[model samples]
Target chain A: METEKGKTFRYLREKREVSQDAKDRLREFNRAKKEILGALKEKDMTVNELGKKLDRPGHEIMFYLMTLVKYGSVEAGDIDDMDEYFSYKLKK
Target chain B: MSDEIRAASYDALVIGGGIAGGEAALDLANNGYKVLLVEKDLSIGGKMILLSKVFPTLDCAACITTPKVSEISRHPGITVFTGAEVTSIEKKGEREFETAVTKRPRYVVEEDCTACQLCEEVCPVVVHDEYQYRLVGRKAAFIPFSIASPRVAAIDIENCTLCGACEKACPPKCIDFTQETEKYIIKTGTVIVATGFKLFDPLKIPRYGYGVYKNVLTSMEMERQLAPTRPFNTILRPGDGKMPDRIAYVLCTGSRDDTIGNPVCSQICCMYSLKQAQLLMGALPMADVTIYYINIRSFGKGFEEFYEQAKGMGISFVKGKVGKITETETGNLILRYEDINENRVMEEEHDMVVLAVGVLPNTDPLSFFRNGELKADQFSFVDQAEVLSSPARTSVKGVFVAGTASGPMDIPDSILSAGAASSEAISYLKQ
Candidate 1:
């Protein structure tokens, strides 16, 4: 006989736990990483300029840039703003 | 590593692997009693190891917990089990009990698997990591963290695509596609409940804008920032990563609120928020930090001094309860609160806001005991016989409680409570 409700554990795992949003965002992150690396290889740019170039939020672009910076693939150069925000460049 | 369901016996069985459980196990082991330490999580250091530093003293938290974890693991008398849960426990004889425990498969063999993280690197599937509060990504095949005891990776079977990518990439070939859940019958003289607390999810209060606004963070999230192995380069606003000069902390987010059904005061939030505020003074000197609270609780020793120190450092303390948080167009947060001292409603805008989250008892599977269930109060914290003398004794004989398993407590209190539990268990065994 069928139960009153579907098994919660299985239901949550199949429906609630699986999110298409995460997979989409991960894909977008990969694309952004490639674009950021390509753009920086051409010329150094501030976070705002890169955001404008990519047509994305400055904050979103900075998140990707920070990961690269941590891995030594990207470097935050001299402070270029009153807020101590820096221009970033691909490490040569 | 053998999964044979053999009936084993021990002098003591510690039900958790957190600070309290670890302490109990070590105490019993040091006292010449064979002990079995079980943890439901992939690793056993518990929530304390995830934190940046301790309160009042500002000592590195990892420095204190790491040595204890390492010692517990190396102790000859303690048998450690991760990815395990106690299913049923029954009293068989005088001061002797039989416990049925089930061990979930980690997919990676602990004996053969090295913590190389190579399989993690190769695994194609990426998901939100809960250990990092879902702020980062983890592969399907992964360990809890770098310093995890046993340091073995587990497969998220729910998400595993069975692509065989991780299997092929393994140097030692520890990944097993076909693994079954293993159960064991453990007989022990005494049992200690030390399962810890879980943080209150702030999303419950939609007005606070935790999940809705990227700028709003939980105190646990902020702790990751102050940690030695920080989540980012420095403490920056999550919304735009522009260093936030103005930050506000909303104290008692989930506690003392009948609306959330948790009316008890979470004892640790007040001191931890103060600790973070002091840390921010050193981490970001120019930043202005303010804490909004219903009341400041400095009940523990030296806690009052710590609060005074933060106030002296010019960290603003407003005795107010925040009613709502609305995100500005520029990703800032405006906290609407009632300032009790001024006797007026006030609104303050800041670059970022942190919610001082509360804690709730987290008994795994909600309930563990069946026939002789230990009595718990309205808050789900195991009811203590007496707070002064019999702090560890439960209604069930040969069963004791420690750490947040019994109630909300600080680290020192948890350790003291663990000692009480160990002593009680020792006395029970002697009888």
Candidate 2:
């Protein structure tokens, strides 16, 4: 829950139609996304390989990978029924 | 040694000891002309010496100007009247002009003022130093700056408040408040009005909140704050006394605005803003600096390189016009600007904001001369004959102007125009 000051800040920010917190978060996310994308572009990698390189848990990496795939942020090869991992590359 | 009025004559009289006047005096004296350079300040080094560095090359401005100060001081044909004011200029003959100049009482004898600062140490009264852009206070009898050329102290009579502590502390007993002002009549072949320029007062803008907000500062104020000898010597917000994590620079505050009646672009403001941003980054390596500019005018040689260097130094160059700057409840600056590329209004908050204020003609020169002798535009000095022509000539044959007295110009242009004015003065004298 937002505090009273945070609520006031939000109300004023909304009246001005400018979101400082949102902008800051978006900037941070964009920076992290760019670093991850650049690493993927450098060489093709499996999910485990990318997770280890990015210093993220396999599940968290899979979440971002799934979101990127949904948004067309990355491309993935077809996964065989018995395949143990998924390979991905950055969308140009 | 006697307290008597002295009458002197010179080939040329330079009314100001700024870049324009200093350069003019040097050139004229070097070319075998007897010159009298009168400066109201206690030293020959003018406003340029107070600056941290010049644009384009980022060369130390003091290093570039101190040599000229020394040259003018050592010139055989040049006599510098520091702490003096030109009262009146009367054209006597076809080519001769008589000027009445008044020298202010220094209180302390120039020869005996060893700059030991003993008088300053014991002086009870402290006054805002106009030379340092009022960023710091000085003793009632104190030198203007650390690099004051003559190394002599000045007596702020207005703020003296009759505190005689400085007089009592003087070891050589040189402090004498009884020193009276003396006037001199100088007959000169020509007069050069190199009164230079004055920075636009940021209070007029109101949006930048310069005078209103403690953290919001003018470019000149920022220069003093960035100086090594600044009172704080750190890039901290004046309001919160905290190092600013993010800084914003608003360009064209008073220049290029038809609303304010200043339509010309202050040519040096853009580059100087970049220079200031670079300097701020150096002082606070972790701070983020954003420069809001309409158009970066990189016309001078190596100017584009300097701009590129600024970008490489991680200074953000946002191509936008700042509309308003407001202080948040947290004492941060909320800058509203239009992102030109995105065509969207962007608002960013910063710890401090600096308004890149423009330069205007020094208005004193207009009041100093007689009515029909010199004509100036609405901004102050006489209008330029043409764009390329030197903007240093007045309507009167023997009178000339230099530096931003004509229009907005950089230091190099001012110095170049000063040299041109000197040649024009020399030619007028010969004719």
Candidate 3:
């Protein structure tokens, strides 16, 4: 059974009609993530290398990389072997 | 020859010279009681003067506060001591307090300083201005700001570097580096603690990436940047100095968060965020502004109207809790939040982000009361012990607290609390 408080979060989205805007904004965000991942592949660089090259905050860069994984632009398995400092490239 | 320096006494001592203190002092003095108003800064106008504009009405904050500052300074019954701090407070008798205050040396005589700013031009050392939220620089010897009441220049001995340029350039020849700090003991029947709250440091929330990302700024920092005389006079990214096409404001950054231990709604964040959005729209007109908030509490008069006006101005309000804020590849902000209405997780990108950080009580007052006569709830406010009474009383008999010292109140609520505190003090005196 759905909990009483948990239902509010579920109903809130439906009532607010955030589907259209959320879908569009998320799509745009994901597109940028894929492009960044593609650029990393072209440069043969890891996430850490891209972070240093782009001068982006590490957590932010990592979050972007995670977005790539969510969008299937970067393989999840590759994230394991990628060095924390030099992990940017996605493996097929 | 009489060697004794005569001492003066007052009915009430008001600490801080901000809106609440000014109002309290005025209210007490108008009631025919002598009031001593002490301010730690060189001028009587407190943080209220630093604001570009106030919320709801969007009135010029300086214009509203400067008049009160002038009135407090000129009132015969109200004596203002700028550049002073309460060193200690002791109970002299039943319902009486003796407060020891220390006055810092201004280096330049107040009457002769003239605010010519000539000393600033010749001063060699430049230091970050604390009054401008450190977004701008000031000379080693300088007036705090353009509208600083009783305009006078002060020397920053810490950053002076002892370069004698200000001393040599002083047309009034008022620079005195060796001016000793003076102490005074004053007795009063009542004390009103109006030391206002401080903005929460956004650095604590690493996910927002405040310090790490130059484009992200706290609400107060945004105010300084929006000021007409601000260094840039434009809302540009600190990292690259580019005007952002889109901006996002994360509401309740520190407040309404059980994890941060500040669960109460900050009371003013919603309205102030709306004000900031309106200001941004006026500046750029085409720039996109979005506010992420869990709930918009427009409980005050004209507050709901202001919120509706922000909506009419095309400012978007997303009912969500921003889970994390990260910077994108293009130096834009990536805000991840769960859309409660959509039943899905979503993220948006914007060029700059502002965190509407909440306020916390000034911790300095606790040092003065030994018996814990003053107490703050979990939210760090000294409100009344019961619901029936005014929310300005302390455990101590004749001492009271007002403004944000009581809780996160807006300008109107702060004024009301100041008036309430004055009445409470008057009643205490009667008893």
Q: lDDT values of the candidates?
A: 0.83, 0.76, 0.76
Writing each residue's lDDT as its tens digit, candidate 2 over B1-431 gives: 23676799999999889888899998999999899999988887778888988887778888888887888888899998898998888887867898888998786678887888887776555444576565444656788788877788777765554445666677776665546688898999999988877778888878777867777988887898787666442554555334677888899889999888788788989899989999888887878899998899988988999999999999998999988888786668899889998899999998889888988777777666666557777666555554366456687778887776787788888888888888888888898
Query: Candidate 1 chain B, which ten residues in sequence have the lowest lDDT sum?
Result: B363-372
Itemize residue pairs with steric clashes in candidate 2: none
> Candidate 3's residue-wise lDDT over B1-431, tens digit each?
12332356899999989899889999999999999999888888777888879988889888898888888888999988888899789887877798888887676778777888888876655445687665545566788788887788997765654546776677777776545577788889999999888888888788889888877888987887777655443565655445677899999999888887777788888888899899999987779999999999999898889989999999999999998888776677899998989989999999889999988778888777766766666656675665365567786778888787877788988899899999999898888
Off by over 4 Å in 1: A1-80, A84-92, B1-4
- Model 1 DockQ class: incorrect
Per-residue lDDT value at B58 in model 3: 89
For every prediction, compared with the true complex, DockQ reads 0.14, 0.01, 0.01
What is the lDDT, from 0 to 100, of the residue B64 in candidate 1? Answer: 95
Comparing 1 with 3 on DockQ, the higher-scoring candidate is 1
* Predicted structure with the largest lDDT when compared to the true one: 1
Consecutive 10-residue window with the lowest summed lDDT within model 3 chain B: B1-10
Assign candidate 3 its CAPRI class.
incorrect
Per-residue accuracy of model 1 over B1-431 as CA lDDT, tens digit each: 45588689999999999999999999999999999999999988899988999999999998999999999999999999998999988878778888999898787778888888777777766555667665545677888777778778888866655555777777887876545688899999999989888889999999999878888999998998888866566787766666778899999999999999899999999999999998988988999999999889999899999999999999999999999999888788999999999999999999889999999878562366776467886788887867677999887888999899888899999999999999999999998
Sorted by lDDT, highest first, which candidate order results? 1, 3, 2
Interface RMSD of each: 8.9, 27.8, 25.2
Q: How far is candidate 2 from the true structure (C-alpha RMSD, Å)?
A: 19.2
